[model samples]
Target: MSAVPESNWSAGRPDTGLTPEERAAEQHLELLDRVIGLEQQVAELQSTGLLGPSETIAVERNLAAMRSSMTWRAGRLVTLPIRAAKVVKRRILG
Candidate 1:
């Protein structure tokens, strides 16, 4: 039989070879850890109150920049179908 490529294994995974299910479980655990980290950051931010003046200004500038971008406008156009579907579902259900 041909040898399996070493590159298929991720360095972050255990040195012991993992079945496909074990690899997926490891990836899921890693993602959960990252999400927990982000939640802690958001909680810290909430306790500190809203953004500072400079942060607010920076956010506004970034939003203005995105609004003027052609690619951003195209992305909104691309999502129109998904948005319309949600609206249609709400109307039919209500």
Candidate 2:
């Protein structure tokens, strides 16, 4: 029988020999999963019909203002399509 080689285990890494591309893909999937979960939570919050407390409302208004700004809009316009494509690919694969 042929001898099987072993990788070094001195460090604290726990990976099971995933290649770089495979590891990157795994991390990407994890990020996509987090986005999906957060979207679900936001949907649930919206469905509650509670506008939240006054401070929360104020914070949300400030957030909306920030989102509406030209800089933010421009950044979103550039980055969101890439993120959307990744999300779409993940959905299609699943």
Candidate 3:
């Protein structure tokens, strides 16, 4: 049989040669752009003063709940792979 080439093995993961810091900076810039957009929205809402005190309170509560939910979901997402690995290892060994 013919030998498989090393280039063929790595073909599935082509390298763009970007450093980790460069990738992180790119992601940071994208997140900053989203933050700027959210800031603009908050400013617009403040200038309009469309929400009364009770409505504002309700909105703030909802925003806090959403933030908490997002944080929880993010933590779960980060741990999911480790959890799956543990389950697989337990099934294999136990």
User: What's the best-to-worst order under TM-score?
Assistant: 1, 2, 3
Clashes within 3 Å, all models in order: 0, 0, 0
Q: TM-score winner between 1 and 2, please give it.
A: 1
Per-residue lDDT of 18-54 in model 1, one digit per residue for the tens?
Answer: 7899878877776687788889888988899588899
lDDT of each: 0.82, 0.77, 0.76
Q: Write candidate 3's Cα lDDT for 1-94 as tens digits.
A: 2332323222466675556687677667766877888898899888987878999999999988886897878988999999999999999999
Clashing pairs in 1: none
* Top candidate (TM-score): 1
Q: Name model 3 segments beyond 4 Å from true.
A: 1-15, 51-94
Indicate which candidate wins on lDDT: 1
| Candidate 2, 13-87: lDDT as tens digits | 666577778767766776687788889899998889675598788989999999999999999889998999999
Best-first order by lDDT: 1, 2, 3
Q: Could you tell me how far off, in angstroms, the CA of residue 39 lies in candidate 1 after the best superposition?
A: 13
The residue pairs found clashing in candidate 2 are none
- Candidate 3 TM-score to native: 0.37
What is the TM-score of candidate 1? 0.47
Off by over 4 Å in 1: 1-45
